[model samples]
Target: MINQLSWKVGGQQGEGIESTGEIFSIALNRLGYYLYGYRHFSSRIKGGHTNNKIRVSTTQTLSVSDDLDILVAFDQETIDVNYKELHDKGIIIADAKFNPQRPEDTNAKLYAVPFTDIATELGTSLMKNMVAVGASCAVLNLDIEVFKDVVQEIFGRKGEQVVQKNMDAIKAGYDYMKEELGDQVGAMQLEKGDGKKRLFMIGNDAIALGALAGGCRFMAAYPITPASEIMEYLIKKLPTVGGTVIQTEDEIAACTMAIGANYGGIRAMTASAGPGLSLKMEAIGLAGITETPVVIVDTQRGGPSTGLPTKQEQSDLMAMIYGTHGEIPKIVMAPSTVEEAFYDAAEAFNLAEEYQCPVILLTDLQLSLGKQTVEPLDYSKVEIRRGKLVTEDLPATDSYFKRYEVTEDGISPRVIPGMKGGIHHVTGVEHDETGKPSESAANRIAQMDKRMRKIKNVRFKTPVHKNVKHEQADLLIVGFNSTRGVIEEAMTRLEQDGIKVNHAHVRLIHPFPTNEMLPLIQSAKKVVVVENNATGQLANIMKMNVGHIDKIKSILKYDGNPFLPHEIHSQCKELF
Candidate 1:
């Protein structure tokens, strides 16, 4: 009676894994099952050990389970590296061409299917992935028609002969498995899910979609790992919508171009990982100083150098929040899920245009690379807010536009190029209200004051922290970015043990949600600030908001991996 199952496939890189996992996940999605899929790979192109873990569940899943119910091994290293994580009663399906190391005298069942052999007989060994996928579905009691349909759609371009060969490979693998491993693995399958279809995609895809919905018509970025999907998606869809995605010479050119487009008055953005982000800092400051509205998506990964490019980490909090030279009022935000990634990205444009400052939308490897199920986004919720822009004809006056006008709210009306009576100068250098270079003491004071004074007046929603319990909580766990799923799961386990616990996740990283977070931290008897960084960056941000930050404890992990729910549960258990 397995209500939910965690299935995984391990093989060498460049072995058609991406397509295999994608096909399986899509079929599962059609059957009304939700999947949270994560890819573990190396920085190299091929011949490296890689794996995809797909958590298939009747209920929506956000985190991978600690153990695997089905381990499909393509080679011996796949078995050697992951045997311990297999459930005692789980079954392993190995390709007969490779002798995968089996658990010694263990109850976990192991069956070898001739994946490559069967595929080769059908004219190509490349169909080995299809054979394995078929065996995986057959053992789980899923209908083969679903797999067949996806195969035809994927391989139909090659003509009927090629499609039929793949069909034979799939059917052969399924029949072989059912004939040999009869009720052993099939025991895990339950009734079909509700048949309610849902969209299944990775985080990068959502971010690109969000950019489109956010009215971002221009993008200039140098592709980087884990974050490149956003650029790839935009490259495909942007031009059809009368937009543009320019692959620049480097991050410097990318950021500068985005700033130039924004200055010309269009929603524009550039995305990058750590190294590229470091290169764009100067331009980010330029956007800040010039008060240009632009968004920068930093899909974070292990850092300092070229640290684990394929791994997940929340190590960019301090870097993004405090980056750039001198002083610039900036808004930093982190989205906790795929759904939030879309909306937060849209709001990022709104905030940037409204505040006339650069906005950094932060995401870790987990939230950027991991694929998961998200409810359909309501595009109606997407309302474009182009802030303080003067598009109408201003009575042809001799006065130049005060693009940097000092006001009660620090925001000034912006006009694009060629606007009559709106011609003004703008530069990275310090400037006055009329965009003229100014070095006088009074002007400097007034300009700096105007730029920095908007912190209090920047209007955004309250409770940026997702509070598990709004009332007095026993223990308050504060985390940001990708830690939301695990924290939510951990809180449920803690309450099951009769311990009243509360969790708060901060989505908006800058302007530090002080008024909203003060009461939550104060009410909790014990507060734990959980993050993936070493210094607990969230804790530092909290100290600036609520005094006596030492009252909150820290649970941190920086090992190039995300926190699992059981890991967080164990960490919280120690506090009691």
Candidate 2:
């Protein structure tokens, strides 16, 4: 029996390809198998090729498998597009309608089942996805009953008859496949899992949940690809806690509205992808100068303009760091995993309030949208620390409340509007301690220095996550965001091949974490920064901050796809 296997479902964009893969993976996840899933689709709403590839393992895995074991297809285009990723022993289950053809170049097996015919006979043709899921179950020798929970949850509201029809489709497909393959049906059975409970969700789900737990009472955002889910999730759950979400007319309105909420004493946030982030930059700079605490999530997608909206790319690294005109202090954080996304998203509010500036939570398209099995998040770990926020009534003085006072640590006492004796000017222009606009050079210098110095003692858990196997290593693989898993998998393979490899994933991006990363770079004979950008932005950031430019190299991919383990491993091997 195999310990792990890769399964994929492909079809037209609006054809329920995603639902089929979701049902299959969720049932397996219920059995406690660790799963990682990635989706490839077009930017439009429908009519393009789309697919969901899932890697299921007895042990935990981070990235998509390098090769596919089974391909479930609705049409020949699915096979024509994705056949090359299959191994020689791979299997393809397709609908008999298309009379699918297997290319002569590959030895992978093909089975044409009557998916549409069976689903139509059961009541609706839409249940073809359920039929496909059952055929997959037969090939893996998995019990069809494992899908009961998911099926009930999805179709139970439609009434008992609808639910039974879907179940019948699955049973019919499974029995048909089992009868044809006979004993061979169990050939690809996966090893049994530990049967532990876990959460199967995407990074956006984690971020939204974390935001709610962190006391974020208001979210104002315009919907955008990848980032829209954060807003969508909050729309449903925020009201349970007396919070709310606003889908503003534009990104500018979203950012400004969130700023207005924070100014009124609520923990407010906004989220968007690259294009929206671009539109929100001026407003972000406004938050910086006004010293308003706001958390913004930048889900990085492929971009310059609207380039590859549904693809993966980290080209926003430099923009996030220095996007706004004329420097004002800001914090940018990158969370490499879904768990970190949750925790970091929660902590972002604290950081924004403590530092009295805008905090950006950064994520690539892959990490933002990829679905995976996650351990139960501990709500006890989420702590809300609104720094220097003066909740108590201020003294009954007539003077402005020294809102932007230049203290030793640069963080001044903060109070919301209408607080007793808390009246002060607020604007984007240069301002003095009382927040009034000022043209004096001395006052300008002081306020600017204070804003910049607030981050000098930034509070963060870990700036860089290190998986070090050697004190001194032949190679150091450095990355940020979603590259963490793929790098870990590559590190394991390289270590087994006798290459001393270490990993450093930057969790905090703005402050650069030079002190933590410098030693690792110095110890290794060579350093390669792997990022999903054309120009190797992360490498340049390291070189500029940590130095050792000669030893630093970059492995870059901007092809709108995430790096696979084999791709990373082979590239690092070549460095030897």
Each model's Cα RMSD = 1.5, 0.8
- 95-169: candidate 1 lDDT, tens digit per residue: 989865686955677889999998998888999988988898677876778877777898899898888888788
Highest-scoring model, TM-score = 2
| Candidate 2, run of 10 with poorest lDDT | 179-188
In the predicted model 2, the residue pairs found to clash are none
Report the number of clashing residue pairs per model: 0, 0
**How does residue 226 of candidate 1 score in lDDT?**
80
Model 1 CA lDDT for position 537: 85
Quote the lDDT for 340 in model 2.
91
